[model samples]
Target chain A: MVVIARSALGKLRGKYDSLSTTEKRIAQLALNSPSTVSEMTIRELASAAGASTASISRFVKRLGYANYREFTMELAHVVVVDAQEGAKLFKELGEGDSLGVIANKVFHSSMASLEATNDALSENDIARAVLKLINAGTVNFFGLGGSSIAALDGYHKFVRTSLNVAYHPDYDIQLMQAAKLTADDCAVVISHSGKNYETIQIVKELKANHVPIIGITSYSGSPLARAATVTLLSLTDEIKYRSEGMYSLISQIAILDSLFMMTVLRSSSRTQPVLMHVRDVIERTREEP
Target chain B: MVVIARSALGKLRGKYDSLSTTEKRIAQLALNSPSTVSEMTIRELASAAGASTASISRFVKRLGYANYREFTMELAHVVVVDAQEGAKLFKELGEGDSLGVIANKVFHSSMASLEATNDALSENDIARAVLKLINAGTVNFFGLGGSSIAALDGYHKFVRTSLNVAYHPDYDIQLMQAAKLTADDCAVVISHSGKNYETIQIVKELKANHVPIIGITSYSGSPLARAATVTLLSLTDEIKYRSEGMYSLISQIAILDSLFMMTVLRSSSRTQPVLMHVRDVIERTREEP
Candidate 1:
């Protein structure tokens, strides 16, 4: 039997075919009522599933848990993650949604997107991006329309580090900046669709110049994703007929934040003094009033 | 006694002094061990507090609960809210923090800040700001340095709505824009310190022009807080010797998000079509590739 750190429900479904008739009953009950089964003891679960306590004990072990307690704990965690990831229908902005309802929905959606993006991100990509950023002569951020906010944010965060970074609000200026970049420089381009004309233009320019491009976009199959040397994806719920990509901004920001933190930590010896100086500047300005 | 919807722990603390000696002992135990008390049955609590079951029943009623069950449910809610508000020490990035640890800490801190900011927000302020924005001729966002990112974000969000909004990256340009505003316009100013020289200059200009200023700042006692017509506060944990107001950006963005959501919903009649059009544009552009 292969033991793995998997969700209880996942394990139950994965191994359902191989289980005994009595154990299959328990697995069915658990899959059907995860929250209820999570809160149940071994005796309660056994009775509910028409199985015995000994079978319940053996069942949890089969799911890679040492005992029932660990199984329940993992189930509880899955329940929370499921709720955050919109396992239930996420309420969209309706005609008569209250202020409190709107606030809750937006916050929940943002959180869900962050968790999804984090799950999709690979540690290897993050490490590679950090290395490229640390070694780059300059970092340029490219985005247009709605994604410009995220591009500007990336520039803001990276400016705090000991790296030369650039972002421009004007599309033509950004294109010019991209054309001037060399192979020694790096670019972080953001587009939720990853297929914007201007965004692809900048990506082509960077590619022609042989500059390393780290693309942040929602679609893994996007043209920008293909053009970039490395791609980081941001995920949002599949809400049809909604406003423009609002939730993905939070996910994109999270990806940038993680990359920034990694870069700072990886180059702490070089960045510590810079960060301390930034802190001092902030402190002095704040204390002035 | 007057009854109200308050946290169980709040009620216990509020009435602790007036309780009888036996009830005071129960109160102390409940206050000190809210999570434990919430999980305990009436008999369990009585024994734990060295009191009788009758006293526990009476104590809950005094706290405005119909019975012990209601009181325990409210206590459980308090525990969850307390956890969200940073009652437990949030893990900070240490010198030797791993990439996974750094990522988790940043994501958790951002979520915590959003929840805290949401809790601190008053619905009335949101409603009023939305109304002001709807009625205003133009909405100008002002922030310098670290807060410029938030200001830009505010601009990005409001620009999606059916309203006129403006923001500039240069401090002098922002000041000039502020000087040109009138009483019919609105200014949404952001400053983590609420004391930056350029930020205060813009605030003064807005104040002199009698424009309605909506200030978002960390400190409630700063000059910007006092100068603004309405102030919305963003709270973060008190961590000394850190970078320049990084976590507060998440809280500030949350505040802006709430305000934006309310604005869209409150004026859905006018903004709904605009949002749909924006969505169409995004869709059209995304399909170009």
Candidate 2:
């Protein structure tokens, strides 16, 4: 695997001539815009290159990479290494900073997280997740500790739509709920670290039941990412003292927010009445002012 | 009261000659940067103008405004009406849009929300909020429906700190918790509309119990904001089709993230051990890879 040691661009150039029609289009896209391509998910790359995700997966394997994740990781490494030769990343948060400075840094980091997470999403992946959510008999949300908040948020947002959704703040109840989901249901499992023991346990249960999963996390190669039917990454520029999980929380919610919007818009007819009813109920709760 | 009909800048200038020394400094700031000053919390204005928040509050009252919130609202109104005469807001999401387009719109809206929310925050407000949290016997989080997600997130983040924190997803439990809080405790209340009956009920309970409230909401005049000891607004450029609550949620989380970052940085000595232990526990959960 000495070929792995070569630059991603160099490897692409070396393998471009021997590629198939669809694979050649993917290679052309990679060569033309390595930086943009580096940030994209496999489904996004397929859409950009007008190729099937399967073909993109096959193309990466043919390039002597283990999987699509590896190919993109190496490509991102190459692009970042090249770009950072001149460009500097963001500043680190320190103890002596004032409140205004802290607010600015947090907001900037969150904006960057949203941008990077958006860059990695594909139309196909979102469509798939929406379809699964809309057609599922029940949508169960799973997360533990810090991530349970995001799971609960996903449940809260989707409930306004026509979907039947469920979430529990308790880990034991979450595991039990995961065990109840079947192939007909969908699960949105959120974990910043992606390797949390309890979250992986729930994932295992869901997988055993053949439930489709939409994993939202920071790592691309974690167990959750590999096992998910469709994975949506929540990325951030990690810096010391600025808990990476905090920014990932913002990115994860943004991803879920996008999915919620897309689902609501795509199925407006089904969601409109539900939304109106919910709004009316909420209005009734308001004081007459 | 007819003075209210005039632009905020006009009001500021009219009252400038009558203000005391500290109040003159506040007026000068409002005149020099009406737009920026419009977005600031009173604490922020105090810090920027080198005056006490009490003086800034009294200054606004002397300017014919009933309160600080009204003063800032009028100023913001003047600034926005002038700026928006030519500049258009963002595009609204539609059913016909592709997933990628939806992702783009959502991310853009979330980013805008963060920026506006950050603009509204004053270092003084954050410092005050942080100080309240640190000194409180227990930090309680209150919200309902959509806002409960933020409340839960606040609990999750603050629990990681050294402070004692509590949150409940049930409205009844939250109300009960609010009632139990006293002047020694602090409540962080989140609501997008700030008019939700259950939230206001909880706010009433907290007020009756004499607990200091940090209100996070979109409307500056909402009951939550009016009653809060320190009001931090979460703003967004609302569009017709896009759910305004969704963007507000993003803004609320970013505000919390900033507060969380500030608390941890300011009290690193106290929180350092807890963070290290949490990190170790999470690391132990990782698979040997």
Candidate 3:
């Protein structure tokens, strides 16, 4: 069996001859103005193409899209891949953007970031990090400000593994914890910019103690990235006027998830009983009035 | 211009005659074993139907799916809506669940929870909650343990609105803050059980002070849910042996997101300038080395 690799636009062009008249018009619009077409709702596209929303839906189906949103995502993927013009598709949260647009943007951005981060990660790094974490005497999670959420999430996920995991919401407590770490410890440090002062301070202390560090940050050149033993980068589209590093949090969470799964799978013999116990406790607590 | 609203099975059955021989086989399999088909990868489906992956892809597209994933999501949606058998689709994370399966389950559950939560929320409640929050001298966020993450998230989001928001990670501080609130203030209380001892204590304080309380929890009959002036239920499927109310967190976040968006949009004239300022600060801070 052979797989045919074609761009979304190429596929549309290849299938254009068999499309219905209304579908042909929609295809022409999509191929000619992909950036504009990618942002349009089905109703908007239908009105633009002088067809009903039903016709628009059929047109996308004819072109191998299940629905309109998937068509737009493929169009955006094509635009990002072929022309390197992702800005038009990943426009920032503008003041006038509608609620539906905001919801779509945030969700799609997260999915895209996760895919990109997954692509950027190497299996070797995951294997190495899992080994280090499983064998460590303790695993300390460090983050401050916005990234603290991810740090806490990492702690929450790892706690089920029955590994000696620690995280403090207080910055000073985190610093003190970092200072006391020995070479037997492993550290997972997260900062979107990779340059938050407090995060760097914690990283410095970890480095001084020779702890193996796994860094999750968006910036490849930042201090935290430079300091870590294994650096996993989270990628996000540069959306202007949006909150700082908001999209990166999704990628960071995905990275932690992958690591957690790897650790649990690799250490199943040791971790499975603990997982069951944790589940039992959770089940009991849930039953409480 | 007439649109035919058909189940996914109906659409497939209606279009079956027009499909190629291989596509017909895939369609028959899909209509007969949707639950099994929904979980199969394209290759698996192809093998099961004695067809190529390309044929399966084309068959789903012919049936109006954007791609295989969307096709499965639609299948899951149909299974959910028709048979009311969501348990098969959202089964508990078993010990042998793969990383991909876990990720897919978690993400899809979050999306499903958001849709369910959206459907459950009353516009009147949202509008009323927004009014009280916007007019309140201070908005206190109360949660404990697992719910604290949602509380912290709510605090993080509200801080950008330049509203007088209060949240303390410490239970005592939170209780003290609750005790000090006046009738003019508002409180957003979150708990999955709705019967957590501390959360109920905080709710009692707010009730005594006549502070308008907006509650987010899974159980509508619990004390916290019964005590609040407006309750927005966060719905999740009952997955036995799963961590207690883990999926509810996503629904809670969605509720908070809706509330945040409504608050920002309704008070835009007063909040726009502050939002812009917040964006500027975030942008500058993001650029720092």
Candidate 4:
């Protein structure tokens, strides 16, 4: 076998460095639009990517494949893999992959996400975030899509303490709620893209209103994080493995979980009453139907 | 404050034994479907639930509310709260209560789901499931939606092991693959509800193929688990929370995490190679791009 492929060997990186100039262009174009490669044949791909069929063929051979078919199959594989939060969520719908494989992928990706998040966090940053929640007059959460679910999750865990909390997917009301906040309160915003316009606008409003914000986002430079007083990042390893957005979601939730635990631990004494009261409510709900 | 009524709560053997028959019925219905109460006023609810207005007032009072208006407001509070999981997504995207109130509501609901998952686990059960995985010839993953994400996640972590791994997401294809399996393989079927039709059908195929199945579901008695060789339960607390499905999902993934750790530690030789190989692949890729 030739030695040119990398991602094909599960390396998940460059396979184009050794290519000639024309081959390099094809490789760049293909990497830039891996999705489109799935629809193109060798000849079409070469032409579209500004390379000759000979260069494309030579590139495939260099990648250590027997021929074009094997190469494109791997290309299809990479095209479907989404690495935003590092979750690989495609394959057989039901009679899916081996359980051992499934279990490993899920756990490692989540662990990677957590590690990424932790790496992105500083003790001072966490201390300050903890302080905000502990001292805040109120905490409001805003998220949408799976983020809403994550926000709700964060809310549930945090409310076990004494902090007053709020969250909504509704933009107008979330904005209004943001308006009601002051420097005395802190806002924890959840948005994977950090570019979600409504959430960015809301974060802007929160900042203008003098509310402290803790942001969780995949991208470092997004508006959501920019407006935040403190930011935590969630890392993913399998983001390029699949799509369906589960990878980043788990990462985002993990960060929220961290914030929640920190807040709960910081104020356990005062939060005991609230926690106890909530437990009572839960017990009551469970007793009957 | 007035008591919101529930139908299922009547069957519950909780603290409500002191209530009269009419009150019990109202309470049961309310517990089962609290949002239904939001549509009916105290008088209408009293008649619909087959109780007199006087008893309805008394019933609401018994549940710890001052009057009907208060009861309804709280009912509305529950109704207007955060998003629920499944097909009914974002239909009535409105701001119901204050963002803080909504936030608390969403948080509590998620905690409830996690609590439920915890309740469903047993040390002996988890140990048994882990043992099966550690010793299995191959472990197959099965799921849909968010569950699919969980399955993919499992694959990512385990691929680092020397184990033979495979995962695909198409249900029809999964059925075919299940047919190719032997009893040596273990299929880990994940469903928030054991009730999803595709999940059930896949389980059936695995059954026919004599492949041992490990089920992950919320309810122990659900068909998917009932038919499995091993079953792991992910529970949710009894809150009429939306995004409930996702809670079960988190629970499922958490259990998968436990299983993955167990497998990794148990299979020392296998674990190192998988991780090292994948890491080497990654390193090579890094050098290229």
Could you tell me the lDDT of residue A183 within candidate 4? 93
Order by DockQ, highest first: 2, 1, 3, 4
What DockQ does predicted model 2 obtain?
Answer: 0.27
lDDT per residue for candidate 2 within B1-289, as digits (tens), equals: 3534777898778777888888888899888888788667788999999988999888888888888766765665565456546655558877787777778788888887788888889888888998998889999999888888898889878888888999988999999998888999999999999988888899999999999999999999998899999999999856554456767888998899888888888888998788777766667766643
Candidate 4 similarity to native, TM-score: 0.41
> Among all windows of ten consecutive residues in candidate 3 chain B, which has the lowest summed lDDT?
B79-88
TM-score of each: 0.71, 0.70, 0.63, 0.41
- As for DockQ, the candidate ahead, 1 or 2, is 2
Q: Would you list the rank order by lDDT, best first?
A: 2, 1, 3, 4
Instruction: Report how far off residue B211 is in candidate 2 (Å).
Output: 1.7
Native-to-model Cα distance after best TM-score fit, residue B144 in candidate 1, in Å? 1.3
Error of 1 at A181 (Å): 2.4
Locate the minimum summed-lDDT window of 10 residues in model 3 chain A: A1-10
Residue-wise C-alpha lDDT for candidate 1, range B12-34, written one tens digit per residue: 64355457899989988876778
lDDT of 4 by residue, A88-204 (tens): 343322224444444444444554454444434445556667788888999888875446656765766666668888876567988889888999998989877677766777787
Q: Score each candidate by Cα lDDT.
A: 0.79, 0.81, 0.75, 0.63
lDDT of 1: 0.79
Question: Which of candidates 1 and 3 reaches a greater DockQ?
Answer: 1
Q: Candidate 1, which segments miss by more than 4 Å at Cα?
A: A1-89, A239-241, A287-289, B1-76, B80-90, B237-241, B287-289
lDDT of model 4 at position A71: 66
